[model samples]
Target: MLYNAVSTLGLSKRLQTANTELQLERLRNNDEIASGKHFDVAKALGARTGQAIALRNLYDETDQTLKSTALLQGRLGTMDSALTNILSAGQDVLAAASVGLGQPSPTGSSLQVRARAMLEQVVGMLNASSGNGYLFGGVEVKTAPMRAVQGDESGLPSPIQIVQDAIAAATGGTSSPQTPAETAAAVAALDDLFATPSASPLGFEGGFYQGAPSTAPRLSARLDRTTEIPYGIQGNDPAMRDLLQGLYMLASVDTSQLPLDAYKPYMEAAVAKVSGGIEGVRDATAQLGIHRAQLDDIAAMNTTQLRILNDQLDAMESVDPAEASLRMNQLEVQIEATAAATARIARMSLTNYL
Candidate 1:
């Protein structure tokens, strides 16, 4: 009989290698079961791996956009609340003016007090902030939009002083208008200071607003792939100017100082301005509502897109839990069997057969 060499070392090394491979496969299957994704995505997807990567990137971008839209929605909601309060405050001032005209207090002192308080309240509203930034600051969100023009606490001039200056400028040193022409001129001066864009130190931009210039475009945000919306409301909005002008006019003067004829027209001018402001604010609120509705529609579309993208990613990268578990069990059995066979073969010797 021909003698054949039994290289047990070589056979044992091969069995050990096979056993290691089986153990590695078992670990991979276990990972797949736990994560519900492929252990080796590139190896599994091969040539389509680039597509998988692109899809994942797209999903992340969409998710970011949705989150941004949600944040903007929250900001819009905050703006709406501030605007609602402003409207209510304006109405309060309006009611006071209307009532005071019919039944005048001895000096219209009570109405002035009410107007001052209302002006402070409205300024507070304009200076309102969301957690992210100021609501009425336009793009200058880090700063308060309006200054406090209420008490002597602030070194800044009060609304009364501003109106007094406007009156003096218009009438050439009169404490109050003495005639209809003077009244019209005074009102016009007040409008110029409060509502017109001018270099006057008492104007809305100089005395009140400390935010982005009204000429600057309002803050805008990307709503979708192609749509951008400018939704920010500024403190220097025409509506805001009109309201502040009316409030300052009402707050600054004493009816007792004016002739009866001048007093009636002055109060009428102020009330008319307040009424215009109220209407303008309502329109602003309505415009914000429309933008909010558009955001809602965009949110819905994003949600649907997210679902579809998730499904596509799942088809490309996700593993069936049941199938992965079954494979893991098979791999476990195979690894155990390989370990046992390697152990037995490692101990093999030709002397035992002999």
Candidate 2:
């Protein structure tokens, strides 16, 4: 067991280096106070930390989406409220008109004023806008869904004019009659005029009232789809035309000549059509609400998923303090023992024996 001095020193140096390295590794792995600078365990933990950070990012994104959905839903709800108000106004007008027609000596001036007010309110509803854009404009974010025409004898707003303009524009340049025709021949001529590429190139070309094109011209609102939702009603839609014409006729009828009983049928029919329009608007509002609710549910589900993912990431990345403390203690003991052995071995010199 005789060992040369140089060989013993070399072995001692190697042992010291190995013990120091082991202690350093333990320090890195342990979640305790560090004795000196060390990074072996930290390097391994760093990889896990990176994964945790990525998971956090994902959670953030999901949370953001949830917030955005909530904001949009709120906007949609506001639009629905506006629609409800508009419907209420329309109902009021219909009720007043019906009563006016029922009066023994009908004076429809008051009813006509009320009807005008209701029409204005309907225009307001059609022009409702949200944060992202106009709600009724059907993806036309910049343009108002309904435009009002001022100072026109037609009593229609600019939005209606825009519709006519679009139709006229589409057909090169030919203006259709603004007044309703009295006789069947006149109506037939009007229909032919609408059909002959002279009045409406962009309207309905066939049916009972075929040849009359859509009043509201479809505009490109969606980039992916060419189909457009005409946001306004045309005067040609039998329901709308009849309603308007009936109102005008009522306004002109002399209370002294035509008995109120005679106009009752027209008033009733107009009321029904107005009611139908209100119902249609209500249905659309309900559909929007449902869509919003579904989005909310999806957002909630995403939030839950994000939470679970975060927990999993924490488990994968977080340190176990108890285990780290135990490893640290074990390494300390090994270092002390190695130091004692080295001191003893180094002291066993030939000079001591002599």
Candidate 3:
């Protein structure tokens, strides 16, 4: 038989290609074992490659959004907890103030001292912050929501200062008391100031909040492509305003300092105001509870979506170790056999046989 040189060379080249393919198969199997993912994504994905990639991108974006919402939820949650504590403190102040109505001890007494401490706690909570941001500062996250300093200056509209001045005028505590007409005029002035704003303290003519008088903006988070929800409140809700007014009213009116006969009307009004404040705080806290519940729901949905998306992605991208190993072994054996055939053919020369 005639030895066709061209055919022999072609056969050798084919064997070399097969050997390279075998080495690549072995490397791929090793990668699959180490990474648990397919080494040949294009081949594994086949006709659905574009669809699978799009789905993966969507999953990643949604996951990122979910993580951000979770962080927001945490901030809101911290604010909610602080508010809850303040609500309890407000209630405690009311309960203490309501004790022994006519027989109460004088200023610096147990009940009055406890009321002052509780007022301090409420102020601290209003000024509370979390994660480097003011929880109740609305869009002004970096600034504290309330000014907590005490002021006795005349005509100062700061809520605490107003409360302080009123009580001082009524009882000769810091300032001298006024006569019937003068005292009536002072009470009317306070009544006009509080009632003018009517809706919220933010609406008050003189700034009730130390921060900017801008209405607190609600914080919003996207849950999905078409769903966005607002989940934040501020220090200036009507309910919060009512609570502060109630607390400060009680704090200012030291029943012991005032003449019980003359200040009977003032003391009775303070008690009524605080009682209403307690209910207002509960209402505000309940509203926060609803927001938290919604947040929990969003978190649950996010978790479920991640689980399903990850499972789907894994099914498309993961390789089975046993199957990859068997294929690798088959290629290795074929490469060895092909190498032996090519070497044997190269050595068979016409002259050597003769």
TM-score of each: 0.90, 0.51, 0.77
Scored by CA lDDT, what does every candidate get? 0.85, 0.51, 0.66
Clash pairs, candidate 1, are none
On residues 141-187, what C-alpha lDDT tens digit does candidate 3 reach at each position? Answer: 77766655363243456566665665465445544223444334444
Worst 10 residues of 3 by lDDT: 174-183
What TM-score does prediction 2 earn?
0.51
Put down candidate 1 lDDT per residue, 1-354, tens digits, no spaces.
Answer: 899876778877887888888888888888888888999999989999999999999999899999999999999999999899999999998987887574335748777888888888899999888886899989999988888775345577865677787898788788778777888999988877886476577677867787999888779998767989789788899988998888888887776567777788888999998989989998999999999999999999999999999999999999888888788888888888888888888777779888
* Stretches of candidate 2 exceeding 4 Å from the true structure: 1-61, 101-107, 149-269, 318-354
Q: Which stretches of candidate 1 lie over 4 Å from their true place?
A: 1-6, 100-107, 151-160, 171-175, 178-181, 349-354
| Residues 210-237, model 2: lDDT tens digits | 2124543532222112322223222233
Clash count, predicted structure 3: 0
Clashes of each: 0, 8, 0
Clashing pairs in 2: 147-159, 148-157, 148-158, 149-157, 149-158, 203-213, 203-214, 204-213
